[model samples]
Target chain A: MPRKSSRPTVATIARDLGISPATVSYALNDKPGVSAAMRARVLEHASAIGWTPHSGAQALRRGRSGNIGLVLVRDPEELSREPFYSAVTAGIEAATSAHGFELLIRFVRGGADDEVDVFRAWSHQRRVDGVVLLDLAKDDHRPPVLEALSLDFAVLGHYSGPEDFVKVTTAEPADAATVIDHLLERGYDGCLQLTGPFEYAHEGRRRELLARLCAERGIPHLHVPGTYTVDSGYRAFQAADTSLSARPAVVTSSDLIAVGALRAAAAQGVAIPRDLGLVSWDDSLIAEVTSPSITALSRRPFDMGRAAGDLLAQKIDGRIPGGSTIENSPAALIPRGSTARP
Target chain B: MPRKSSRPTVATIARDLGISPATVSYALNDKPGVSAAMRARVLEHASAIGWTPHSGAQALRRGRSGNIGLVLVRDPEELSREPFYSAVTAGIEAATSAHGFELLIRFVRGGADDEVDVFRAWSHQRRVDGVVLLDLAKDDHRPPVLEALSLDFAVLGHYSGPEDFVKVTTAEPADAATVIDHLLERGYDGCLQLTGPFEYAHEGRRRELLARLCAERGIPHLHVPGTYTVDSGYRAFQAADTSLSARPAVVTSSDLIAVGALRAAAAQGVAIPRDLGLVSWDDSLIAEVTSPSITALSRRPFDMGRAAGDLLAQKIDGRIPGGSTIENSPAALIPRGSTARP
Candidate 1:
């Protein structure tokens, strides 16, 4: 590669024009103090000199980095394996790019304290104009840290705090109601829910909603705690299958877990939607391609991401106040072969 | 949110110390010329006042942004659907975060020109120290643009150009050789290779390698152009099935396409591995969970990403010379039910 000349700075242009750097800065930035002709002359000279504004300098002056941050406090293996985070990220990228902002992502391998440290650093350094938060747990500590730091942000999950930031969520109770209604309509007598970690706020909400809905209709319901992985789903299904007298329709927190249940049923020689019924929480390609295509709640994660991105952008620009809520379309159940009971 | 006071800057510390800002900068940065006692006094006072170095100012002085960039020139829908990009990104994050560098990602919905424009803007602004380039096409224009900008970069695919840039690649020829060997061992009479778009350099290479290997072995080889999507895979399989006289074993460029082909076969009553053998080029969850789990070549994209990240980091730090090449572990064929013909 050819060794190129150093980039031209504001001082370089000022030196060429024999003018004060302050005058050039004011004229180039279109500040009010500079006369129109002076501004035009400064711009022309700066253009001729091939001077591009330094982003660092520009960010410092404007108090905006033109970047948005996303910190994922997830196991790297889990982050890579799950499709949910990726789709949401793509959606966020779609919206942020349309607004000419870049996404700065950091993966935290450690616990919540390490995640908080990242936010603190970004806040102090002004590395991003704002951020988007994901995977809200019960009493998530991140919101309070971000609030104390005065960093503009939007959450992708429900937060129960008094001080409301922008939250983009799917209708949780409606999701549960839809699932129970579908199961009852299919003539399933009992329901088994394979839930994600109860530490997550959404998981707790889903459990409570499902339990209440099942009780009102006099349907027996069982709750099994599991992580969002295929192994978790497989084990949960095996444990449920052996322990229960009657096979209940299985509802999983994610498609991965549903896939595990499908594999387990196939291995055990149990016919799906006959001896067993399976429903996945988030629909993706995985749900559609399984031997017995899984009935799934299409949460539309990409749209959720787009909504969160737009809200955060608005929050960053001070166009919208805090405590705003935008509910994405409620999760709609797409029944496939897995739940096709005759 | 609390109404917090503004953050303490260097000037604030200087004002509190009744010293010149330059002296404070020198003391805080631990530069020579400050007396030991004076430096200690300045440090104590700065710590007492909660003064932190502004990242913008520090970057301006150091000419490093403490960030790396990755640009994806892909359809947003495609990006969100494919697990490959996400896994690769997660791998990149693992490496970059380990080195204390953040990942800056920008998705370009347009063609190559728009992608190049992102590079130019990022270069001019010093928004990233170096970038990782993906999906190199025939006669790709991006390398030339990045080279001209004097930006340090690493390519994730083969770059035939003479200028030595770090490249992380898999053994394309070996991938073809192994697939053919696997097919022949399974007693498949003919081969139908469903490929991604020919515009990509790797696709062209794979096609040539497969064609040559098949010709040498006198195996009837057919190639169909598709994309890294399930729908494309479905359409390609349907077209191939109707046009061909005898059903040949199908090999797809990605798991999504394989899933599509599987769906098509199931719809048409073509028994997998018995009537038609199926293999996916990239192993993923979709491949593993399909009705007859797909036989696939595990490309280990995450490892590829990690390699690319490490190379780019080294390139940016000037630790390694240009033209460095790192070949990831060869793609291994994982035999599953899809190719278990007796």
Candidate 2:
């Protein structure tokens, strides 16, 4: 790992190659002045020396390309329905726009490795000053790669790994506990948790917390997998074995999932709050308009997004140190008709 | 407007200021070598002569920041709910990514003017090679401004009035006619069209088409406004006077609004199909998950997105001329329980 001060610069590369800094700059920037052969030689020497442009050269020192990079890695279909991202991205936008910075966003079709390549490519081209990381998975590959490249970044969401990056986490664990307590208080003997793909860091956190809490209270619970889409929620509901002695009150990861369950229940002639109770995460508009309006976790996504964006800005500006954890407004449970007592 | 060949170049600016091209490049790129006073004088001269760097200096010619710009100008809250953008953006991503281009996106809080400013800023900073314009309004302020700055761009969605730029339309007019024909065929005497704010070009087009069609057929039609959020949809549904004889069958621009109407009907004891019918646009997951799976216009937002993206890439690559229109797949009306004949 190279120390910050020791990172290769234009001057260093020029001296090593016995060339003027002007030639180095032209070759590095793909300017027309340098001959193709000389440019290749300069590039080869720079590569052998492990040279990468410092962020200061691209943004801080030169005031060039004031931008931040954010890459979204999700099925485009799923991304369209997930309100969480738009709100968070908006928050990031608000912060960046205020600072006169552009947010350079990209959507990668492939998984983590592809995402890593994107980060590398963007950084190499000096496209962004810093990046904001979202949905950090367990043993995520991003942080180490970003660290190696020495890119300023802030990780959004609860990632309890060893990466030193500015971090922000929504209160998913606490929110799950609140839902559990509410379900039990409503005299529900068993519970069903319908959640987004558990591979994501926060979903995993919620799953672990809820499962443990249910076990500790001696309450029977069933966990169902969903993709945070209406179709996935519908399928999860359709697939759940619902013939148990005590019907499980349902808790979902998103409003779309809950709505799917609600529609599935209607089709099955199961009555909400009579045969079952329901609670949804993210108090989005869908929760309000659902037939027996859903009880939901009011974890203001927009505000959380703003916090993440602001944190990234702070990290880039060097106002905050890496490994700093920002506690967002705690998630609050908003009780609605769907979770009404039997 | 300056023709392509007549556009200002580094050499042109250098000659105008009686300095070398290298000095001009250094002053413009904020590189050391040029004196601060000389740099200021060069910048002033360049600005006075409207000498913007050709895309070559930033991207096309030099391969600096292989990026494209896209600015979104919708309410953050509404953006999260509207699946249209995610699908379209994903399509754009697929194209840009395939061509090894990064997308620089930003969300602006204000309207068309704010969006115009974003385009100008991104262009002036050499942050993007070209831009992909979305949701262009009637008499949009963007194309003209973009033209004035000579920024390479492609407009997405329908903008009917007159700007000549690479264009794509979502077959919305034909889709509106299809929905109208379906409603009449299903024995619906009157129709209520629920839509996003009419100020948006597409929504306005839908509003005008439905109104004209209904008027011609002597069918009463009402256009209720919404912001594409579930709550707004709910309010629109509630505020819509349903007491008229031959109670209007609901046709919503988005599934969110249709779902909101469905829930409102359920709460009001207004049985769907028996008392009223419904149809939704976009054919999103919500349309399928609603109690009576909503009849919808399957426009394939993903494919539409891909088309927009491909078109932009072509324009940027100079494979297509400006003002070229790409016709999206014609909208297909998918019949579901919600619009069953009374």
DockQ scores of the candidates = 0.53, 0.14
Clashing pairs in 1: B164-B323
Give every collision pair in model 2. B56-B61, B165-B323
- Model 1 per-residue lDDT tens digits across residues B1-342: 123425677888888889999999899888999999999999998788767666677668777777899988778767777888888888888888777788998887887888888888888777888889888887888887787877888889755556589989878888889998988888776788898898888888888888888789777788899888888988998888433425468888888889889889989989888888898889988788887999999999988999999988887777898988898778999999999956
User: How far out, in Å, is residue B311 in model 1?
Assistant: 0.7
| DockQ, computed on Cα atoms, for candidate 2 | 0.14
The parts of candidate 2 lying over 4 Å away from their true place are: A1-64, A196-199, A224-245, A256-271, B1-65, B194-199, B224-245, B256-271, B291-293
Q: Per-residue lDDT tens digits of candidate 2, residues A1-342? A: 111233356898889989999999999989998999999999999888767553333542353446788888877667766677767777788888777677777777678788898777655445566788887887777887887656678888878689567877777667778888988898777778898877788888888888899899888778888787777888999998665437578888888888889889988998898889889977875676566778999888777777777887777776787777888877888888887877
Q: What is the interface RMSD of candidate 1, in Å?
A: 3.9
Considering only chain B, report the TM-score of model 2. 0.79
Tell me how far the alpha carbon of residue A321 in candidate 2 is from the true structure, in angstroms, after superposition.
1.5
> How do all models score by TM-score?
0.94, 0.77
- Give lDDT: candidate 1, residue B25: 88
